[model samples]
Target chain A: MDQHPTIDTRQTLETPEGTDLSLYPAGFWIRSLAYTLDWLLRIAVVVVAGIVLGASGMGQGLTLVIYFLMEWFYPVIFEVWRGGQTIGKKSLHIKVINDDGTPVTFAGSLIRNLLRVVDFLPGFYVTGIIASLCNRHFKRLGDLAAGTVVVYANSVAASPVLESVGSRPVPDGFNTDEQRFLLAFAQRSSTMSPARQAELAQVLAPAVAPGDPVLAIKQMANHIVGDRTQSAKGHLL
Target chain B: MNLEQLRIAIRPRRDWEAVDLGLRMAQQWWWPMLRVWLIITSPWLVAACVMPPEHQWLVSLCLWWCKPLFERPLLMILSQGVFGVELTTREVLRATPRLFLNQVFLSLTWRRFSFTRSMDLPVIQLEGLHGAERRDRLNVLHRIDSGPASWLTIIGVHVESFLMLACVALLGILIPEEVGAELWTWGFWGESRTGGALLILFAYIAMAVVGPLFVACGFSLYLNRRVKLEGWDIEIAFKRMAQKRGLPTVAILAIAALLQLTPPMLPSAQAQSEREAVKEEILAIKKGPDFHRMETQRVIKSTEKKEEEIDFDKGFWRALIEFLTGAGSLAAAVAGIAELLLWALVLLGIVLLILKYGSWLERFPQLLPHRRRREYRPQTLFGMEVTKESLPDDVSSAALALWQKGEQRPALALLYRASLTSLLTVGVALREGSTELECLRLAERLQQELGIPQTSIRYFSDLTRAWRRLAYGHQAPSDAEGTALCRDWAQYWPEVTRG
Candidate 1:
C-alpha cells in the first residue's frame, strides 16, 4: 500500500480560517418583517382562543391567562429544547447562538425573555429600539441579557478551484523529479496571491532553466509533469 | 510529540461551514402582533353580532369609545375562546392607551420626541373658524390639550358629553312616538318633541347639560387657583410650547407630573355645587326661544334691569367686613393649600426615588461565579492591556472589557504583530489589509504549504471564533469557560505560527 505523506499538504491547503460561520447582520426591513410576522401569529393565537372561550368575563379571564402562559413559556421551551427558536424563527432560517458560538442554555433563554420587561422601557420599547439601532450587532435588550446572537443559517464553500496543467509542451532543462516537486509546490500555492506566486516562481525558474530562465522553466515543468496537465488547465495551478 | 508538534497534529478544521444556532428570542414578534389584531377586531365583531339592529349604532359608538382601553382583552378573549388558542397578557396590555402614554412619556423624557418640520398647527386651526374668536378658542383648546391638565380636562369632557347624550336619549325615548313624528316635521327635534315629555325628563336633561359644564367651568377656576398656588400652569404652558416646537417625546413626558397636580388637588363637588343651581337655571331657559323669552320677560318685569337703584358703597363695604369675619373661608383655603403641598411633596419624593435608586437596582448580578482562575484571565498570555482588577466582579463587566479590547485588534493579529510575522513571510499568510476571513483562508493555505494537519489549524479558527463572539454577542464573554478559552487561544498563538 502507498504510504500517506508525512504532512498532507493538500488537506492543509483546503482548510479555511474560522468555522465558515456565515452570519449577515440582518437588516432593519428583514427584522421588521420578522417582527410583523411574529405579531401576526400572536394575534391569530389570541383570536382563536377568544373564539373558543366566548365573551363572558370568566371566559375572557381564562383566555387571558392562557395567552400569558403561551407568550412567556412558548419561546423558553422551544429555545431550550431546539437550541433557541420557536417555529417561526426556525422557518425564517435563523438561529440564536450564545456570544461564544455555542447553543443557548435554559437559564440564558429564560433570562432573555424575562428581561423583555426592561427592554419594553417607558412604552413601546423605545429604549430597546434605540439600543438596537445604536448597536452594530442588531441586538436589543433581550439579546443583551441573554448573551445571544441571531444569525442566518447558511453554509459557504471552503476552497478555491485550481487550473489544469495538461496542455503546454515540455521544455529541455528540468528532469522528472524536479518537475514533480514544482507541480506539488504550485498546487499548494493555489490560494496565494499572484504577486507572491510570481515572486516564488522567479526564484525557482533559474534552477530549472539556467539561461533561458522563465521559458525554459515552464517547458521543463511541462515535460516532467506530463504536458502541464493540472497547472495549465487552471485547476488550482 | 513536542507541544508544537502536538498542536500541529490536533488543529481543528476551519471551513466555511455554518452553525445555525436557531432564531433569536427578540426576533419573534408574532405574539404582540397577534394580540393587537385580536384586540381591535373581536369586540367590533361581537358588538356587531350581539346588539339589536337599532342599538347597533349606539353599541358601535360605545365600543369605539372603549376601543383604546378594551381592545386587547376583547380580542384575546374572542380569539382564545373561539379557536382554543391563547397569548400573553403582556401582549394584549401592550396595545392600551396607558401603554402608549407610558411609551410617549418615556420617549419624551428621553429627549427623543421630534415632530415633522412640515407640521403646521396654526394652519390646521385656521381650517375651521374665525380670526380673533378662533384664536381665543384655540388658545383655550391648546391649554386644555397640552399637559396634565389636558388629561383631566379630557376625562371631564367625555364624562359630560356622555351624560348629555344619555339625557337626550332618555328624553327622546320618553316623547310620544306620534308627537316625535309631528315635531320631526317642524324642525323641532331639538325642542318640542323631546321637551314636551315629562317635566322630570326636562329637569333631568337640564341637570345633565348644565351640571357638568358648571362643574367643568368650576374646575377650570380651580385649575387657575391651583396654578396660582403651585405655579403649575406656567410650567405646563412652557412644556406645551416646547412640545409644539418639536421637543422630544421624553422631554414632553418629563414635564407631565411637574406641570399638573394629581386628581386629589381639584375642588370638591359640594363646594362647586353651591353655584350649580344658578348655572342650571340659566342653561335650561337658554335651551329654546319660548323658554328664553318667558324667562327674560319675567326677569325684566321683576327686577326691571335697574342700573342706579342700588347703593354700591353700603353693599360693598358690608360684604368686605363680612369676608374678613368669615374665618371658615380662611381655614378652608388653608386646608386646601396644605393638601396641595402634601401631594406635591409625595410626587417629588417619587421622582427622586426613581432617579436615584431605579438605576442602581437594575445592575444586580446575572449568574453565579464559577471557581476558575484560568477562565477569568483569558487574555493574559497575549500581553494585551486588560484592567481586570479594576473591573467589577460581575460577569458582564469582565466580558465588556475583554470584548472591547478584542474588537480593536483580534488576538491572532496581535500575535502576528508581535512575533510571528517572520514565519508568515514565506507562505500564503495574511497581510495587514487582509480581512478576518481572508486571514483564515490564507492560514489554511499556509497550513498546506507547511504540511500542518487540519486539527493544528484550529488555533486560527478558535481565535476568529472568539473575535466574532466578542464583537457580535450582546453580552461580553462573561463566563469563566469563555474567558479561559480566550486565554488558552492567546497562549496557543506560537504553535499556530510554527512551520
Candidate 2:
C-alpha cells in the first residue's frame, strides 16, 4: 500500500545513544517578534545608560564601549551560558542549538553572532529572511555556517483530563499509540461540537457496536487509562 | 473536504506553531501563489504608474486597499494546493471572480483593519459562512489562536514597509555615485516625477510579496484550530483502521480465536522426558559466548556552576573605571614598559628569520648587501656513487663493449649512471631514493635552472626509460635500440668522461 507520508516542518536529529530528538525550527514572524522585543530592550538599556553616564564627561567613552559590547556579544553571552536562549528567545519559547542537537558552544555562538553582519546584507535582513525561507530547517546564513539552528524549546504538556465514564474492557487490536489516540479523542470531545464528536466516534462503530459508539469509546478510553472503579458495575450490566 | 487528501500533517499545534507552518507552506508553494498574485496585481501597478504625478499616491493606496480582493486567488491556490491539488493559472483566474464576490463590502470597509483578518478570511470564503454563523465560527477559532494571528498581521505590515524601503535603497546603492549626486541636487523625491513613480512601484512590489504569505498563514491557523476542535487526525486514523479490517476479517479472527481455545494433547510420560531434555539444551545455549557480558566505567562530572563573563550588574563598570582613574602614575609606567617590550619583540622576530634561512639569502647574491659564493654536490644518491670517479674515461665505448659481451643490463646501467654523474656535477639536485621518473623530472627542471641544452635532457629521458624498462618491467631493449642510446649518450655528455 502506498501510504501518504505525513508532511510537517520538523527537523529530527539522531543521537549517538540511538534516540531521535525532534526539533521544531521557528519561522520568520515569531522570530521577528523576538528580534523586535530584543531590539526594544537593547535601546532602552542604552538610553538609560546614556542618561546616567551623561553627567560625567569622562564616562562618554565608557558608555560607547558598553554600547559596542552590548551590540556584539549580548546574544553570544546569553546563548552560550543561558541554555541557548536570549531574553527574547526565552520568552518566545525558542532557543539556539547545534544542528546535532547538542547545547550551543561558546565558539558556535560567537561565529553565528559575528556573521549576523552577512545575514544583514542587501539591507534590512532581506538576505537572511530569504535564506531561512529557502532552507528546510529555516536556517539563516549564520546558522548554516555555525552548524546551529533555532528550535522551539520543548514545553511540557499537562496530561489530558478525561470525563468520568464507567470503565469497560477495551477491544483487542490497538497498539500503544492507537490507544493513546483514543484517549486523546475522548479527552478533547468536550471542545468539539456534539455532531462532530459523534461523527468522529461513529468511524469506530464496528469495534464498539450494540451501544452508543460515543459513550462506548469513552468507557473503553476510561478503562485503558486504568480507572477500574466501575468494573464491578460494568460487569453487572 | 476529504481529510485523506489533505497534504500537511493534520495535528493540533500551538497558535504560533500554526503560523510557522503557514510560513513554511507559503515558502513551499511560493511560486504558484506568487505567479497568480503578480498576474492579478501587475495591472493595478500599471494603472498606478500611468496616473498623474500628484495622484500617484492615491492609486497606490487603492491597490493597497484592494489587497484582499487580489489575495482571494492566492488563497484559492493554497487551499487546493494544501489538499494535494495544484491549480493552473487559468483555473485560479477563472475562480477569482467568484471569490471576490464573497463578503466584498465588509472585507473592504470594516474588516480591512481587522488584525486577525487572515484567520477570519477562511471562515467567510471557504466555509461560505455569513452573519451570526460567521461570528460564532470566529468566536470558536479565536479562543486560543487570536493573539498570534493578530501578531502575524502586525509583523507583516512592518516587514512589507521595510522591504519597500530596502528595494528603494538597493536601487540607490546600485546607481553610480556621479548620477546620484546629480539626482541629489534635483532633490530626488520632491522634484522628480520619476522618483515618485518608482516609490509607488516598489510599494506595490512589496505588497505583492507579503499579501499571499499573509493569507496562507491565516488559512493554516484556521485549519489548525479545526484540527484541535474536531480530532481530525484521530478520525483519519480510525477511517484507515476500518478500511484495513472490515467485516470478513473479523469473522476470520473469530474462527482463529475458537481454534486457539482447544489445546493439543500428548502422552504424559513421553512429553515430560522431552521437556526436560529441551530445558537442559536451552540452559547450555544461555551460557555460550554470544550470551550476556558486563563491563563498568567510572567518570567524574563537575558540580560547580560555570562563571559567566559579562555581568550586566550596575556596580562592576563603576568600580572598574574608578580603579583605572585612581592608579594614574602606575598605569603610565606599566604602559611605557609594554611599549619597549613590543619593539624588542619585533627585533627578535628579524633575528630568528636570519638564523633560519641565512643560506637562502646567499643563493640570491644581488638581494644581499655583500655576496658570499657557495657550491654544493652530493657524493651518493639511490645507494649509488654519482662522482666523476665512478664513470669510465670513454663512457659510451665502455657501455658498447659491455653490450657486445651480451651484458645488456650492465651496459644500460653504466650509461644511466654517467648521465646522473654529469647532471649532479652541473648542480642538479636529486634527492636520495628518488625513483627513475623523479630523477628524470629533476633533470628536465635543470634545463631552465642550469641552462642545460634540450638534447642533453632528451638523452637523459631516453636513458632513464631504457633503464626503468630493463630494471622494473624486465624487458630488455632491442640490439639496434640499445646501440642508438649508447651512440647518443656520448654526444649529450662528452664532458661526463673527464675526471
Candidate 2 lDDT for residue B83: 68
| CAPRI band for model 1 | incorrect
Instruction: List ranges where model 1 is wrong by over 4 Å.
Output: A1-29, A55-62, A156-237, B1-499
Interface RMSD of 1: 33.7
Give the per-residue lDDT digits (tens) of candidate 1, residues B337-441.
Answer: 545655677799999997998545333212213332112222222233223332223323333355456643343234323222322432333333345566577
Give the runs in model 2 whose Cα sits over 4 Å from its true position.
A1-6, A156-159, A234-237, B1-4, B181-186, B247-499
Alpha-carbon lDDT, every model: 0.41, 0.75
lDDT per residue (tens digit) for residues A1-237 in model 2: 115454577777787888988888888788878877887888888866554443344444556877998899999999999999999999999999998888999999999989989887667777778788888778889999999999889552454687777778778887787777788878888888888777777777777775877878888888998998987765554
lDDT of 2 by residue, B220-306 (tens): 898888778777777767766676667322222211221232222232445555556445545543442224441211122222311
Query: DockQ values for all predictions?
Result: 0.01, 0.18
Chain A alone, TM-score per model: 0.54, 0.92
The residue pairs that clash in candidate 2, if any, are: none
Lowest-sum lDDT 10-residue window in model 2 chain B: B249-258
lDDT of 1 by residue, A27-129 (tens): 2323433544666787788767665443344545767987897778777887789867666677665566675566888888888778767765544443454
